[model samples]
Target: MNRFILSVSFSLALGLASALLPLSSAEAAGPRCLTDCTPRVGIVSAFGAEADILLAETTGRREHRIHGRRFTTGQLRGNRVVIVLSGVSMVNASMVTQQLLDHFRVERLVMSGIAGGIDRADHVGDVTVPDRWAMPMEVYWHAGAGLPSPCGVAGDLACLGLRLAVGEDGRPLPPFVPDGTDVPAGSWHLRQNHVLSRRTAPQGAFFFDYPVDAEMLAVAQGIEPPLQRCGPRATRADGSIDEALCVRQVPRLRVGGRGVSGTAFLANARYRDYLHHVLQARSFEMETAALAHVALANDVPYIAFRSLSDLAGGESFDAEAGALFTSGLAEANEAAVTLSFLEAWRRRPRR
Candidate 1:
């Protein structure tokens, strides 16, 4: 028997393989496995809507299930590609990315999805291809505000919050002193990720920001995608388009800016403003940064297209954000950009 083949009883007796899901009797026979998982490009999305357009365009698709996630390999615009939905949130995204990398011989990765708009420059329905991505929630939240409020209110003291978890000299944060700890209400310092390094930053150094492959970014930036300023709303009785939801400015395909992601859904207007001003973040979403992190660590070239679905923090936490995100304009726009990039890249000279 081939070493690649496994019997479920034998595998369980030995123990589960690292980072791999439990295998069923069907998978043990190797029938469900793809004979060849190789593909030139691996396209990923957070959910089905984001990938609906690309999936429709893909040809000769063959699907294989791993850990219950579907990975479909096919020819996209005449280029070899594998596309999968990463589900949603940071952990799910990371797991799916690693699985795709491990199972498929993917040379490059492209992410297409909808994101909340943080910067005023990015209007609703605009497709943003940020040069870099980061996780803004990597912070040390304090028990309470350390600085006294100038306005003398508990919430007002947040205005006086400490902006840095690290010292001015660049040393790591000391143990929590609690009562005298200098931090804001949430202490959203947008602190450094003192783990893996990027570019010049050495390992174990502060590296919150992760830059996508330069060549991929250039190819992405060079193309113009058909973007929509208005999207249809299901709430309308006659199924007519909603004018208020339409972007005030002509929807643009913007390149070069910071994008931030988090595990939580961000909907507070004040927090959105802070992310834009403090981190200069243009796009906000749940999964892209985590996906980018895994790709960068693996040394695989990667890029993402995030369509702005709504003004961040514009919707009430439970109500509007969810509805706005499902609008087809943002989903279709990002998918369009991803398809365009793939076509352009297919014709480009070999690296």
Candidate 2:
């Protein structure tokens, strides 16, 4: 009798262990019943610092994990929401966004983060909710002297407005080939920059501008969230206040313009000016455009708010001579704007 009872107990324990294991591929892929069926607004950020403010304020939060990534479901500004970090680059953004969509009942998507400001006139700490986003780095890097110059008379149907990629000093950059490649296939020069104002032939019907959801954009437009323009004020050991990292002007919110993204961390001023002039790009970052792409494919209404952390071409950390790298308020300011937008959205009259 004791032996039989022990065998039954072992079987029950084994079944319990199996139930707690991660779902198998086929099971996870199906539209199976999730433990939580709550419809939530998805808030995506590229990294921890950007998501930290929102995460801190989230109430009634519950957490879940998939393949080690955390997806937190919670209430923010009186709305049901799910928030996750999409990691850092364009590829990371694409992967995590697809995962989030597949696993959650996400009704709408909202993204906010710090970004490189393309125009010098646009100071750090200011927030911008771009009307459209694009992956400007997708391009055919022309073979040096072989491809027809789009600005020249030989420019034809294949030209696709090809322009010489320029440097920070506004000089045309010399093209170079990648280290490992078969020479017989023809040498190809890599252009870190590209002109994406139009589509390349046979890459049929690709978009240079993916417009954000019009309705969500309209909601953001009416929101006038106050933003921080300086670093966190802290007390010294003697209780004296330490200086805050202050930018040139009071941070303000601008609602429309194009925001461009690519794998590159932008530092080239000449390229920055070109994008601002050619594409009307106001912000540069690594993730938002990719997130926009994912949201569009999933038929989800999406919007992103980016706060300028630095002048893209001008102020890197060491290049702080002119105080251009005012490493403050960008994350907090964007988060503030996003939370305010959420509040406004919750209060918006239902259809």
Candidate 2: Cα lDDT at 26: 41
Model 2 off-target regions past 4 Å? 1-35, 144-205, 234-244, 315-328
TM-score, cand. 2 vs. native: 0.72
lDDT of each: 0.72, 0.72
lDDT of 1 at 61: 88
lDDT measured at residue 8 in model 1 versus the true structure, 0 to 100: 59
Give lDDT tens digits, candidate 2, residues 58-148.
Answer: 9998888988999999999999999999888999898988888788878799988878888667766788899988766664455544543
Residue 276 CA displacement from its true place in model 2, Å: 1.1
Please give, for residues 279-335, the per-residue lDDT of candidate 1 as tens digits: 678988999888888886666788988877777788644233344455555676677
How much does candidate 1 score in TM-score? 0.72
Quote each prediction's TM-score. 0.72, 0.72
Clash pairs of candidate 1?
161-184, 267-313
What is the alpha-carbon lDDT for the whole of candidate 1? 0.72
How far off is residue 346 in model 1, in Å? 0.8
